[model samples]
Target: MKETAYLLQAALISAWWVGLASNGVFFAAFQFDAIPSTAFWAFFAPDVILIAALSTVRAYKQNSAIELVILGAFAYASLYCVNATVLTASGYLPTGLMLLGLAYNGFLCFSDSAFRVSSTSMTWNAIKTLIQTVCIWTMALVIVPYVILDAFDTFALPSMDIWLIIGGLLFACFSLLGLTSAFFMVRDGAGTPLPLDQTNHLVVSGPYHYVRNPMAISGIGQGLAVAIIFQSVPLLIYTALGVLIWQLVVRPIEERDMTRRFGESYVQYCRHVSCWIPTFGRRGT
Candidate 1:
């Protein structure tokens, strides 16, 4: 369901906020939007609107689209303005949250009804997934670092591009892997990766031939690469958290879903190829 993304985003962002507040700067000094200020209330009101938009938003509905555009467009813009001029230190928090929220919205825009719907043309699947990929990559690779750089003034890395080069190379490789997996899912499986429109058939081709989850592997690797490139401990922790979530929470649900959907075929496939880890001598490719 599209609500899943919003709910997940809200939870992740809230955790991020709590971590920052409890660890280093509990509402850093020199803030322009401190409590009891009209400026604070102004930005706060927009945040509420942003939250409300996420709550009420639905996918593929013209009215929902219009509402999101009107409310989300202005609310995000207003928050940007405030972040630019007023908020200084912790200000970057809003920027990062907004960008991530925008990334989620990109997914919300393309997928149809919350639950799995009828199959769509491969073209539509490609388009929607492309938008989602671009938004997610931009937010994670670009926007997240920028926000961290700004907010974490004291958190400095070496003034060298060594890590950047390494991270960039690793990110590129995994991104290619992810894209290749998506392509196979679309071409062979006849669907997009969005839960709202999952693959119609079991996709055991291309990267899936070797690994059960090239995308998950790619995502984890890319996340680690980003953290390494930036020399960011926080990002490293984030990568670890991602791994735990995938292994503990997401993987179980997804595996159960796959079993329910595909039955014996999926179980047999799992028996052959390992999930992410390469079992080269397995019976099936």
Candidate 2:
């Protein structure tokens, strides 16, 4: 059953990547009339970076699920980017900085893959796969309503005159920082890799000092950045949903397993650190 699950995940992820590459090419083929909206540029362009990064890392070893997921994310981003091009032309796309951050992090995910010298125990990482399955569906389901409403916001809902651009830029900067921290933590061995996963270490340093789950926080930040850039109310709602799901549903399960495996040290670390949010105090000072 475990192997079956892994194979299924691998197949799904591979299909996703292939689709992403195909659509990415299609999206690139069409030229935008104006500066692509921040939303479009932020989410769409960096997908290649993510694909390359994940592929490079996976090449070091074979990780079916992780590979598939990285590919799947790129495909999803590609599709989103194609839509962003249309929205940008219509002048409805709201932000760019957030998109830039997304691209930057995507690059980091790839570049960080350059560092792995050996393989280690990634036992019981299947729990993460289960969490991911739930998380992805949750994200999609939560974002759908907003997408529908946003699709017709121009015709049905009144477009707010709020400064979404500023918010989007702020979001992008935050995401960039988060991604940088996450990359460094993994690349530098601040954290160990989850068993069986082909990424990096557990990453309990730098940004991880403040938040036990920097990557998850960064993911939420990225999602929020997208919402702010586009000013998509639905995406905003989904961002909130994503945060809650990650915090409430996902982290607890992973942490329990991690704590059991890592023992008292993991518990001690958890004492000083926050899960989704970063702590400001200096460590061991």
Candidate 3:
């Protein structure tokens, strides 16, 4: 069953890749703008729908931590895609390709099997928390610091496009959303409330009540926001691609893992809450 699940997931992912490659090639050949965003959504939406349809018959085991970490990488790649696309569309050929390559490599590095496994549910969620730690740390220690230093020492507001500024605001909102989930994970232990090597606990605090994968949502939001900030067509496309990839790879893995880890408890949660968005009445308070 596990093998079948893996194979099915793998096949769907491969199809998505093929679709992306085809779209890219078609765009290049025709000298037209390749809206990979639409293509990606179109190609993978079916896979998601199909998987969702079949999940009722047999639940797939998943790894939440692994999926979240990969998602972080997906967010990074999405940023690159949008940025690179913009450069390319703007007629900066070599630079565009370079950014494009960078985005691809970043995603490739993070999407390996080793990086996609969380042995226990607690560990799976903890792994996501750890990723947030890394991201938030980088934002605090590197990106933010650099931005601030540049702003203060140079006496200049960073050269940001209006889109990028918008992206930044979006990122802030999403990052906060992710942090909400992260806090619950930290507070509970791997599954929630603090770091632990052991897997246990089911979190129902902070952002969990509002959504299942707030961190994933935040990561995606940040990616889109960054794409806007960069205003890069490639980046934006990549952002869309990233979301598709997350829906394809990360979400399924987490869902399966959580379902297995929590069983009826998770089943109950699924009934009451959603995987990404909130239930109709439950607001993120």
Candidate 4:
């Protein structure tokens, strides 16, 4: 029998597939213009091979190594393709698909293993987290912003040089905070920040002591910084939308998971720590 976690992952992948297809069709037919048919197929075509391979492994194999190999190849090709078309109108589609596809593929890999967070070595966890961070940053800060705001020549502020300097400074500071927090997670907690390989221990020694989610706080700040640097209203709104998603949707679920895993210890910590604002004098117990 599959673990509940793995089951949820599978369900989520299925739902994503259905939702994207249905919504695309609906919007195209009744509400708004849709992406080109070829662009849409380009996004989903590779997944056909991937799904078949992963299903094969699930049925007869003991591990997902072969599936992982194929995914790696596809992901590598996707990186090159992303670079080539990043400035194009429909480029966001493939870029977004790459992120979601890797996540779904990882879910399939977890299906084969009796999975648990922090089961891998700290080194592997750190490596995975770093790579994931770079990919997401490339998408959010570089690719998507250029495609959405820059390529289309969106409205930009006049005094952007000064704003750029300030935003760059803020980005560096928040990035340092995020990296430092990740290092603490790896060294002290024996895991990474990503859910697939989260810390085994409750990490409260560094930034976690001041806030329950320093990484999240840093991430939102970094997004805001990017928006400021770009001086694009659309980018600012995009970052704000992401903040809203994290706060309203992701935070509650994450807190529940932490409480479930860490029990009274987490509950007690939550009492002292704020989720968004960092406290200076007191630390979580």
Q: lDDT per residue, candidate 2, 145-179, as tens digits? A: 34434443522432444546665666677666655
- Estimate, for each residue in 111-183, the C-alpha lDDT of model 4 and write its tens digit: 3342346754876877877887898778767777675564344635536488889999999999999888888
Error of 1 at 134 (Å): 1.2
lDDT of each: 0.66, 0.49, 0.51, 0.65
Question: Candidate 3 on 80-196: residue-level lDDT in tens?
Answer: 545655755632332333344344334333433322322446556666667757866575334533332332232233365676577678878887877777766655634432222
Better of 2 and 4 by TM-score: 4
Residue 92 in model 1: lDDT: 60
Candidate 3 residue spans exceeding 4 A from truth: 1-132, 135-161, 191-199, 283-285
**Model 2 residue 147 lDDT?**
41
Candidates in order, TM-scores: namely 0.64, 0.44, 0.49, 0.62
lDDT of 4: 0.65
Best lDDT goes to which candidate?
1
Using TM-score as the measure, what is the rank order of every candidate, best first? 1, 4, 3, 2
